[model samples]
Target: MWSVVLLWLSCVPAGLQAAAVYRRDVPHQKVEVYSVTLDCTVTSRFAHTVMTSKALNKANSSQEIFFDVDLPKTAFITNFSMEIDGQLYVGNVKEKEKAKKQYDKAVSSGQTAGLVKASGRKMEKFSVSVNIAALSSVVFTLTYEELLQRKLGHYEILTRVKPQQLVQEFKIVVNIFEPQGLAFVEAEASFLTNDLLLLVDKTVTDKKAHISFTPTLEQQRTCPGCEGSIIDGDFIIKYDVKREKSLGEIQISNGYFVHFFAPPDLPRVPVNVVFVIDRSGSMSGIKMQQTKEALKAIFDDLHEEDHFALIIFDNKIIKWRKYLSKATQQNITAAQSFVKRIKDNGSTDVNSALQEAVKMLKNGHRKNTIPERSTDMIILLTDGNPNSGESSIPVIQKNIQAAIAGNMSLFCLGFGNDVDYSFLDVMARENLGLARRIFEGSDAGLQVQQLQSPLLLPGNLA
Candidate 1:
């Protein structure tokens, strides 16, 4: 029971919301947010969420407004649009470079420029500013979609709502479709807020699910000129479907189909794991301590069939083992000790360190005498940008690409807000994996364990 409690306490939802206020050239200008609306639709295999925020100018002069919002790393944005001075501007998804070029072109052509781009794992930081005439309003809308990833026999969907400022009107609606029938469904908010009113459709069916809620703020009786609302956390929903005994399930809707495959009782396969850590000076305090703790926990949980290596980098790189070693009792203990002794001091060399990790994995894959098919993966933990060696992001990206050549998957864990999450996100996507941001205040070990689940793909269930 205690272990269960600890696990739940450690593994809370991993969404962090940061707010950036628009700076007005003329100080003391007032900007009032009028409303915020959220719509989410979920199917057995996928979910789509959209947010629209409307704000109006309260100052006598024209006002400029900007909004920065974050989203989960797994989400793929589908659309972004804005209404300025009664004109609507919709942004189309394009290649990152192409999108940038389009945005630049719009600005140069004296048109309303709008852009939506991914900044980090499960997070999209978007900022758009337009000059609004006095007493005028602007509405900005963003839509994104993500796979309803399955875990522990259920499907999960998560959405974040944080409009830094309290609005006059706020609402959210969720629609879920599950032709397989829902065994159960649950929705919850992270904090207590009277503003959130959940609405459920009376026409309930085994295949249909729906929920709607509104978050608002009320004048605080205790404090003058203050408001009360839970505007900081995530809105999460999870449900399990009644499955017919089969190796997989498929759902079809409106000419689109989704397949869910879960192989049964697959034996564990051996895996080669490499830990690439960044020990820059910026990671000297609590960040380093938590990293060590996470590493220690990972070490203690390793299976004997697994082979592992550790590579730490700052201005220089150090390898715990020249080659991968079996995760025996002795080796695990040694690895734990090595993790305990890691100290932070130098500048970061992200490019070279990652290259070294991939090289080690490649060499191990070719030379290992083990007969079982072992998956090769590199877990990179960093807290800073590449500054010491091969500092250019593009150079580092191309170099790592050439080194791995699609031989191994790279998963990155960005330590704190100081790290370049965009860099990590891009690198992971290129290598057939993903990146995650470890909020400095959360349990780093839990985040590490979350990523560990992907290691247990049905084909490599260990």
Candidate 2:
């Protein structure tokens, strides 16, 4: 009988231990309570979550419990601590933004959205601790937000995620939607792919999305026999996409389009050109007259931002203006008048002319020293060879090189065959510029055309 009593006493302790554990039952989920009652919304644009309840129940009643709540995936609760009836529960609460199925449909249909959209999740939870209690309730809240889609015209998209609790594994899914009858132009998920230009036919679809098309070289329809005829044409184009992803179906009816045109965008660089003209005896008649006309045309082509200085070289380099000035009507007229007054001189000292031009450019560089507007250029025109004062090719080349290194572009114009083409070529090549050989007759205008062509081309040399 005594042995039986001892066994009963041992069983009593086990029963008491089980009875000591307590759990509190909450009717509503903690997230629901916080969102509805406390009016707390997740503020993160991405996925985020927070727990709203931190209570314990030590009652001795056994009961069923239910958790309910409407939680967004963008909640911003940084940390969460919870205990049920003095016992911490090992669990987690989370929220996530759902991806749209329409996006995937759009990609398949060839109506891809230019912007990239991503998805994210945030969650917080705790383990239940052992303590005195009855029935207990554990409440959690989850929220998440989808990543933004890539912007229109952007070639690539990237997304990232961080979970509140460390997880063993995870999976992500992206769907892309395409317009009906839309063809895949090109796509790249990894950064290691070459970007390809895509062209869409205007007749293929009536969608209003941006399109890219290779510019077609239209036929030179203008009469080739006509003098001074400028030929030009454009190529038809449609929308273009460089990268690819399976984010979701994109809708074509939504007007997500791509467009392109010929010759791409061209960047214009401001120019500060000094016109150094030779008015020596050789440039007296037709040469001088043609030079005046060419100068006028050049002045007309000057952009409002371009700066110019006119210098006439004969017995000496005479600056019509002491400094560079805007190509305004007043300044252009003044320059033209000065050119008209110039008379045929006795000698052609090209070296002195060049030195004076360099001096002007150097002074200008030191004055209005803006960062990108520092480009300087010299357009040197001559009919006769260098006649005096350091006239050797080597000496001239050395001076030209120094000016170029100081950010000056040199263009040499050889009027008539009497002018040395060899020297002109060397000067131009050294500065990555151009050299034009003008014939004696009416075709001299061709030299001006040649000079203007290089100026229009896109490059730092211009």
Candidate 3:
């Protein structure tokens, strides 16, 4: 009986040792890491790691203290659940999954795995997501493909993450596959809604190339009871650095266009013009000659559809035209002939000419009936003071007020020293136009250029 008992004890010790080894090898609940990748592009390529976790507690005891992971400062996270000690924590799990997928795909495709000497290119960074608690056994495997391309001859890959219907983030990673070299970098973004916020980060391992930046955004914000406000945001940017030739050239083209095109689209409203010229005695010499030349240029530049009329103020108000005409060859030639025939006459009646121009624009003759066209315009040019009908500046101003009530634009040009520039400036401001002074010795061509430059083209006319 004693011998049998000793044999049993020895076997018992062996059995206990086997059980301990089994427990050490087997986990109560497995933690597996799976990869998900996002395929798209982001504006800026900043280096950072993103962590994602999901846990399933099958124990009936409802135990807490499940998982913990460190997060990077510049990383974005969403759709993750956290349970500390005993309770479930609700956060953004969707965003977490999206971020995970982006990173995983980037890693598996060899796009973000560091440099590969065989291809003469290297994977600089990756976008990846970690999936835990999905499989019963702790197993890790890559699960996505990434599409990579060369932009302006530089290696770059884009990854997109859609966490919610209204929210999204893009990750653009550039692989400096070449040896250390200098590169230029720029970035921009356009969102469907105004409230979306964007974050951009860039880093260069080596310094060798010059960088230029041009950024633009077409932003629209909604207001209560008011129509949406459209704003164009543009920034001029430049940077220079040096590095290796192996990285090639990183050309990001989407961020390139806004540097050139945003400003011209904003606040460009059509202009209204009224030609008020002096056909008086003082303007008879080269002054009148230059005036006519300037007038012809103005006529030539007028949009075919713009609103304009000619009122030559001399001893009397000569209303040669009552409606704006296209700058067609025929109309311009006829207008030019009329301007040439304008001889130095008795006295200057500036007030009468202004009144008549305003009257013609306000009356809206048969030829001036385009729908939705902007305000009418009256361009006034003169070389002498009011010496005829309604010479009072106040009376001329009253006519101008009436024109404004009708929504007109008034521009004034004064030639020689005889005209009143102060009054011209007042008229221009009242009607949202410009007032300019042309000296006797000034180049008439230059004056013409200035006058014609501001007139809207036919395509620009509303």
**Which candidate should be chosen as best, given lDDT against the real structure?**
1
Which residue runs does candidate 1 get wrong by more than 4 Å? 1-39, 43-152, 156-172, 177-199, 202-208, 212-237, 241-260, 369-371, 456-462
lDDT, candidate 1, at 319: 94
What would the per-residue lDDT of candidate 2 be over residues 259-313, giving only the tens digit for each residue? 2221333456677788899988877776677687677667767766677898898
Q: How many clashing pairs does model 3 include?
A: 52
Whose lDDT is higher: candidate 2's or candidate 3's?
Answer: 2
Alpha-carbon RMSD, each predicted model: 10.9, 32.0, 30.1
Q: What TM-score does model 3 achieve against the real structure?
A: 0.40
TM-score of model 2 (CA atoms): 0.42
Candidates in order, TM-scores: namely 0.58, 0.42, 0.40
TM-score of 1: 0.58
Give Cα-based local distance difference scores for all models. Answer: 0.68, 0.45, 0.44
**Rank order by TM-score, top first?**
1, 2, 3
Shift in Å, residue 45, candidate 2: 54
* Predicted candidate 3 versus true structure: per-residue lDDT over 262-351, tens digit per residue: 123344444456688888887777678778867866766665545555777776776777565555677767877887888877787877
Task: For residues 282-374, write the lDDT of model 1, one tens digit per residue.
Answer: 788767987886787677667888888999999999999898898999999898888888999889898888888887877775675432477
